[model samples]
Target: MREGWEYKKLGEVCCPKNKIQRAARCFDSSDKILYIDISSIDNTMQKVTDITSVTFGDAPSRAQQKIEYGDIVVSTVRPNLKNIAIIDRYEPNIVASSGFCVLRNTECIERNYLFHYVTSDIFTQHLMKITTGANYPAVRDQDVRDSIIPLPPKSTQLAIVSELDNIKE
Candidate 1:
C-alpha cells in the first residue's frame, strides 16, 4: 500500500442521493422523464447513451431511482458484463432503474475517482463474486457498498482522476 493511503468500504466515501418513484407518481402523470436502465449504458463506451424519454404514466416499474448530474450508476444485474457510467448530462427529471446501484460521492472523495474505481476491474471482480441469481446474476446495493477500496490522500485522488480522464480523452 502507498503511504498516506487507507482502505475503506466504498460506502464510507459515497451514498445514493436519490428520489423515489412515488414522488414522481404524485405529480402530473403526463410529464416526461429521462429513464436510465442497464441498456441505457453502453458498456463498451462506458457511457450512458440510451436514455429513454417516457411519460410518468408509462414509466417502467424498475424506473425507481432519481439521479443527479455526477452520480455513478452501476448495473446491479450481470456484473460480469461491467455496465457502468458516470452521469454527465443533466436533466431535471432523470430516473434510473432499480437494477442500478447509484453512488453519489461525498466531499472527501473526488467524483471522478469514485467513478473510475467502481468501473475498474477490481470492483467488477468483487461484484461478480458476490452476485446471486442464475439467469440474471445480480448484485445487491449492499454488496457494492461493502466492497473495499483503497484511497490515497485527497490530492492524489484528484491527480489520479485527472490522468485517467486525459487518457480517456
Candidate 2:
C-alpha cells in the first residue's frame, strides 16, 4: 500500500446497514418495475443497455435485489467474464437479479473508485482463484465483501477515476 493509504475490506467501506434482501413478491403484481438481469448489462461497456420493464408478478425469482443509482452490481456467476456495472440511473421500481451482489458506497470510499477497482485485473484474478464450481464458477456475496482494497485519500481516488474515465473516452 502507498503512504497514507490503508487496506480495507470491501465490506467495511460499502454495503447497506440493514443488509435488507427484499423479495420480488414484495412489490405489487400490477406495478411496473425496471428489471436488470445479467444479460441486460454490457460488462465491456460498463453500462446497462437493455433493462426490461415488467410487472412485479412477471419478474423472475432472481430479480430480487433492489438497486440505487451509483451501486456497483457484480455478477456472482461466471465471474471470469467479469460481468459488472455501476448503476447510473435509479427509478423507484428498479431491481436487479439476485445473481449480483450490489455494492453501495459509504462515506469511506468513492463509488467510481470502488467500481474501477472491482473491474480491475487484480480483483478479477483474486475472484477467479477463490470462486468454486467447474462449469459455472461462482463466488458468494461474502467473497466479494471480504475482498480487500487499498483505499487512498478521496482526492486521489477522484483523480484516478478522472484519468480512467478519460481513457474510456
Residue 27 lDDT, candidate 1, scale 0-100 = 37
Task: Compose the digit string of candidate 1's lDDT tens values, residues 1-169.
Answer: 9899999987888864333333255435687888898998999888998989988679888877778898888898998888999989878788888888888888878888998898899889888889899987998887888889899999999999989989989
TM-score of each: 0.91, 0.93
lDDT by candidate, in order shown: 0.84, 0.87
Residue 162's lDDT in candidate 2? 99
Residue 65 of model 1 has an lDDT of 78
Which residue pairs of candidate 2 clash?
Answer: none
Candidate 1 wrongly placed segments (more than 4 Å): 16-27
